[model samples]
Target: MAGNRAWILKSRPEGLPDMSNFELRDIGAEPLEDGWIRVENKWLSVDPYMRGRMNDVKSYVPPFALGEPMQGGAVGKVVESRSPHFEVGETVFHMLGWRESAAGPASAFNKLPQMPVEDHQWLGNLGLTGATAYFGLLRVAEAKEGDIVFVSAAAGAVGSAVVQIAKAKGMTVIGSAGGADKCAWVRELGADAAIDYKDGPVVKSLLAAAPKGIDVYFDNVGGDHLDAAFAAARQNARFAICGMIENYNAGPPPAFRYIMRVIAARIMMKGFIYTDYMAEMGDFYRDMGGWVASGAVTGRETIHEGIETAPDAFLGLFKGENMGKMLVRL
Candidate 1:
């Protein structure tokens, strides 16, 4: 039997994770059990959420066990199938990521539909990334037409989607990115204004971008961004607190000097996970799928080739190295 090479967590990371915490090991491939399917992974998703999983603390999702193959989202082609539902050569999406291949029961995978977009996109724009933006902005934030919306980490996978989706809904969108190039990309995605956060204090820039005050804030990078949103939000404003990438590496949480604004402004703030809105996934797919197919809601990806580069791809998220979605093409 051929050996399957997989990335395993050697130890839990204290702050920023490095190569020393991971080890690639070769394990002998075993015969498929009943109702199992063997899949050759073609693409792997490296997301910010996976950073939380590397820690030992309890979270919405269980921490990645030491010595086990780390997992995320992956799209693969089934080469062998013992189940009637899955067939040889069929493509499917599953959570068995961070490896070159996986063998699991057919129930663990969802078959991909025939679409004009590439199969890898099923892990990105047309998939969880897009869904996160859709539900976070529309459902959680309750954004409406003519509302002023601010999105932190605006050029990232989920933030970029929020920028475009808010635009599609006729909202005035303000985006914040770390550099000039990412800021430009956010503007190109139809943001009314894109703030280069590296240039100055985000609160000042957000105030300048939306002097009238923001109605909805889609927060991807929390900390300073959350403080700025609180200061710039209008009365009865809504905040959808998504991932807080700024504090992912383990550091002092950002002190909010303007927290009083949350009360004075009567702001509604809610932290949400995408899975919380799983019941509305069908609506998300229908709407986001149409917008993607029509080119109204666009998405970009930073592809890192080879499974060996997966760790680098994930680490790059902290450096703001990716403009949009980051994926490893296996």
Candidate 2:
């Protein structure tokens, strides 16, 4: 039998996490249960949202249990199955991540939908990241044709998608990223303008990009980005609150000085998770698939090799080390 290895949560984080908080353990492979499948994990996703799950705070999802295997998004192929819904050699997406192999109930896994893309795309543009951009921009923000749309983390996975989707929908898109290289990539992704927040004051750069103010804001990195959007929002503008990566490791929520603008501008803001729109997956695939096929939307990724490098891949997220989706290829 093949040996198995998993990354265990050794301790809760204090501000920022470190290698000491995680433990890589070798364990005996347990037999598959009657209604479960055993999968050889091929790809593991390390997203910004996973940071919240490490804290012992109450949120939409439960925190990671101490001394247990960590979980995120993973793609794998079933090697053995005791469930009718799955078969040997079938590729799947599951939440049992940070491990080389996994055995879980059939309900915990979903077969990857057929797409003219690579398998790892399931953890990037075709997965949660894409969904976050699609629904947040189109539904939550109510962005429409000719609307001025602004997205933060514009070269990252969800932000890049937002840049493209808004442009494809006829909206003038302005994206904010860290450096000149990322900003240039955002423009290449079809954003009308790309703001390099590292250059000067974020608000000043954003105002320069959209002089008339913006109608929709797709927020990925909160904090200064949120304040910038608030400062540059036009009347009746809508904001979709996605991942707040900036504040993930902070002690408390950022005190935005421009929050008062919400009342004066009547800026509509709503926080959301990708799971909130699961029923619309079919609609998402139809539109996103078409866009992908026509080169209207592109999924980019930053991948690290081996399951052992999963921790580094995850830590790189906060450091802005990833270009698009950050994944570990096992």
TM-score of each: 0.98, 0.98
Off by over 4 Å in 2: none
- Residue 51 local lDDT, model 2: 93
Give candidate 1 regions above 4 Å deviation: none
Poorest lDDT segment (10 consecutive residues) of candidate 2: 245-254
Cα lDDT of candidate 1 equals 0.92
lDDT, residue 88, candidate 1: 93
User: Per-residue lDDT tens digits of candidate 1, residues 225-310?
Assistant: 99999999999999999989999997878679899998889999999988899899889888888999899988799999998999
lDDT score, candidate 1, position 200: 96
After TM-score superposition, what is the CA distance of residue 134 in candidate 2 from its true location, in Å?
A: 0.7
